[model samples]
Target: MEINLNKHISGQFNVELEQIRNDVLKMGGLVEQQLTNALNAVNNFDHDLAKQVLENDIHVNKMEVKIDEACTRIIAKRQPAASDLRLVLAIIKTITDLERIGDEAERIARVALESFNKAQQEFLVSMDNMGRKATTMLHDVLDAFARMDVDAAFEVHQSDKALDKEYEGITRQLMTYMMEDPRSIPKVMDVLWSVRSLERIGDRCQNISEYIIYFVKGKDVRHTSEDDIKENVL
Candidate 1:
């Protein structure tokens, strides 16, 4: 949304770049919707919604392949340099994370299919919290990437800690529920897997945020410390 269009001198190359960016954003929207639908399916135990999530996955996969090919072609023909090169490379990384997030969502949807009838609304507090956090993180990261806003990206990165804590608490709660009532073990396991998928989605969002910083700063921060990231990222 905040792309600097003035950097381009060639109209044709600019159009190609915009096309790839548009495709990437469109793919992001699909994954975001898939994640939301998957969470709702688990929250309400809606098999229909779960099925829809699965059905929509083909589009996400297709978008990834389509965007990847476009990026490759742009690199080959445009020979983008410096920051433009970074933009193309960052898109490649972002799409990979988005696709993985989609997989996690699909996995959660499958859990819904397995345990929709087993859902205990009262016991879903932690899961709901985590799901909302993941959804917000995903949305925020996309906005940050679009705007190239380092501060916004860092905000999402910081929120990942709270999401991780929520997942741990959910694990503990589910474990206790199982121990207290062995009869509930099967149901608890189903919810556990769903929580695991949600946590993984949060992780993928964090990875995307890290990539936002990496391309902005022109340095890899994957293995860097948080303090270092703060110091290094613009």
Candidate 2:
């Protein structure tokens, strides 16, 4: 199963690397679609759609497992070092985050369905915005990975700030409503969970961006400042 970098170095290794990249991109695409569908389910208050999202989560999970196994096999057989090893490791880490993002989407969909009977229209609008932002971030992160565009990946990292601001704004508005009328507590709680789920999804996008940086530059940028990350973006 070993692939010697020195022997047949020109053609076979290049093709193998391309296959790895394509496989990772395929997995990323599936996770992106799941996030999009989950967001739509939340915004429309479509319990049937939400149920479908929940059921299809198993597929996403299976994809994650398969991708991880593929990466493991490549690393074991290819004995990739330096950049190649980093790319394989990044795919492994990124897929884990993507799978978690899918899990979060499913959690939000479940909450949306559970509150379908009681959710108020006023709160749905804010939740819809949160869902949109989360899905957009996920999409951007996956695109960055597919292209290995460091600048685009950094853009995805910085974009988390907006999602956080939106979540904070929603929190304040919901708190105001709850304070004005204690009867809004239950609905507000559901909205809180939905917003939290979206916020977590944004955080996962940041994780993906970090993995992108590591894959490209062999650096760990997590917990680092934006200025530092921007400086490293090439």
**What tens-digit string does per-residue lDDT give for candidate 1 at 1-234?**
648743677888888888888888889999999999998987777899999999999999999999999999989998998778888998999999999999989988887786433345546556787899999999999988888787898888888889889999899998998888797787778778889888888888888888887777778778777787888665
**Residue-level lDDT for 32 in candidate 2:** 78
Candidate 2 error regions (>4 Å): 1-13, 115-119
What is the C-alpha local distance difference test score of candidate 1?
Answer: 0.85
For residues 3-59, what per-residue lDDT tens digits would candidate 2 score against the true structure? 222233657666777776777777778777877777777777778888988998898
Local lDDT at 89 for model 1: 92
* lDDT, residue 33, candidate 2: 81
Error of 2 at 140 (Å): 1.2
